[model samples]
Target: MRPFAVNRIPRWISGAVLVLWAFCVVYPVFWSIMGSLKDNQQFFNGKAWALPKFPLLWSNFSYTWETYHFGRYFVNSIVVTVGSMALALLLSATTGYVLARYTFKGSGLLYYFYISSLMIPAILTLVPMFFLFDTLHLTNSLTGLILLYAIGALPFGIFVIMGFFKSLPRELSESATMDGASHYGVFLRIMLPLAMPGLITVSIVNALSFWNEYPLALILMNDPGRYTLPVGLAVMQGEMQYRTEWGPLFAGLFISMVPILLLYAIFQSRINEGLVAGAVK
Candidate 1:
């Protein structure tokens, strides 16, 4: 076989595989959105892939928002996701800075400890965490959920941020210190802004994870009113099984997807830059 022909074979195979993977991921999403525009009878009686009839049922989204209390759940998810990201970013940035910049006693041990936490499956800790939170009267509360997400996400955040911080030249911090900058000033003015790429990447990653997280949210949020979007959607699905409002169910799923999609769309460049820089460094 010609050298070019041999090389083209793998390229073609890889391209085909990627196209198939893309279809697998995107087709269901497209189907859900289309199905959301349909009504129960059309969705069930008509072909699964058929387009909605003229004058789409846009009301399904409204019904989901008002009738099913998804509005409350949506707000709860926003609050929890934002709060968790803020808390996690703060903790990760500070801890990562210390680990990267200073050679304090046991700092290596501490850094490894954080990294080690990432190895353990979160499911293993769920029961113990639930009991601990219950003791603190934090169960079924948004605040508790936020804290849990922050803590759960911390290990990976620190790992990513620390790598970025470590890649920076020591002279940057030293020069800032010589120019009458305090440790706080250097960190706040110099390091933090410089580390924006990593922080953005971490925030986007954690946002997606927290937004889609279901099992822990299900376990923590016992009150119907406290449900986040994922938990709320699951509960709504269960309730709708008998009622079989497929359109509204798919509508709820689409609504839950909007924020995260918008988030990724906005920060996609930053995420790519961060990952590339991290990998290069």
Candidate 2:
């Protein structure tokens, strides 16, 4: 009984720690939602923990959407996220599959090259990339942004997806090939389906980055019409300085959070499963 009670003490401590961490994360989001409902006085006054008052200011969302052209930004973000995610996943899958399965001259070097690229500070290359984009006429365009994002995260996606490929039982691919399946057929029908978890993980990770990216968009999206959500939000925040409109700002933040929350909620289980399985492999 003494040993059992002592073991339970660690469990109790861990549970308490998790609960505290959860509160730390969730309470601020809850407070922000409540803040979105209140006027500046109730929000910034001495009632930070209090619930919103009666007659919720739902107009905050409407006003921001219409007046600030957030609707346009929302659509642009959707387009960029989807387009870049699809392109990145496809490229990563194909590249990772070959690299993980086949050993060719310089394959090791090439993989290391990608892994090493992660070390170079990304910010350092921004100015050079911007000049290259300008030279090639790739600036001020969503397509250019999509291409940049797709290439930018390719190393990470390749690393993750390659692990999935290497971990998979080679018997599956060999069995498919024995039945007259070509390499493409084996990959498309067998290996690709088995690697869904890695695919989802890569897409979700890149989707979040592409959705929230700002610095590149800030430099390239020179035209107001081409602004992504983060850039648009920054612009809005600047304009809001004189007005002090915290309500709409909070509302926009809430809006920005919805897609990411939904994405994780939908694919939460798969993400953990993929990481664990790939790690073991």
Candidate 3:
């Protein structure tokens, strides 16, 4: 048998493509970080690509946090994202487990309904949702925003988790049941742990979406003090029309992205695992 030989040209081409893609992703984030360290003059004086000025203005972050109430907005974002993600995971896991394991008459119908919802554009529901929330006296409330975020994430979460649950061997549940484990016990103890990769993947995806969500948050949170980070950033940009504090604005934007970056970095391995699992199974 002949040994395989390296394809140098194709390898070089692939390397170049990857390098370009990395640059495209990294440069904007790098620029934003550097911009946040400089003052407005440096940011606007066609020096965005230039080295930041000496004595970096790290105070820009503080100004953004204190003057613009970015701290409050940041807290609000954390609360909403965490709360919504927790609710979404619980609901999706339970629903996905039942759909994957059971043979009830309407189970297939319900699963398809969730799958179909992914096709419906969320914007189409805005007006009706607004009226519904208003009628429920939930508009302008963090709880309302949290509920909306969780519900919005449910379809995708269920889809992902259902695949994982279905991929597991039937013997696992059967053995647990033979040992006198209740359905709830089999799920909570045996199945949920096995589904960790999918849960982590869904959590990261939903967290990023909830963290960066702007439109629904803007409409729901009327009080300035209740605004999430994205809405606060928009308000900050609007203020920039009068006074161009580009540095601090970029600082706020950079801050907004850090949590998501950190989240992906931490769960990146599980993300890959979940994707591969879904694909293979």
Please name the candidate that would achieve the greatest TM-score relative to the true structure: 1
Can you tell me which runs of candidate 3 are displaced by over 4 Å?
1-17, 44-46, 272-281
Structure candidate 1, residue pairs in collision: none
Give per-model CA RMSD.
Answer: 2.8, 2.9, 2.7
> Per-candidate TM vs. native?
0.91, 0.88, 0.90
Rank list by lDDT: 1, 3, 2
Who is ahead in lDDT, 1 or 3?
1
Query: What lDDT score belongs to each candidate, Candidate 1 first?
Result: 0.89, 0.86, 0.89
| Clashing residue pair totals per candidate (backbone < 3 A) | 0, 0, 0
Error of 2 at 234 (Å): 2.0
Cα lDDT, model 1, residue 16: 100
The true-versus-predicted C-alpha distance at residue 40 of model 3, in Å, is 2.2
Q: How good is model 3 by TM-score?
A: 0.90
Off by over 4 Å in 1: 1-3, 7-18, 269-281
| Candidate 3 clash pair list | none
User: Residues 1-281, candidate 2, lDDT per residue (tens digit)?
Assistant: 45555577899999999999999999998987877787787767846688878899898898878788888889889999999999999888998999999899999998999878877887887899899889989888899999889989888888889988999998999998899999999999999999887888878878878999988889988888888899989998898868888888888877778888898799887656655543452
For model 2, give the 10-residue run with minimal summed lDDT: 272-281
List the lowest-lDDT window of 10 residues for candidate 3: 272-281
lDDT of 1: 0.89
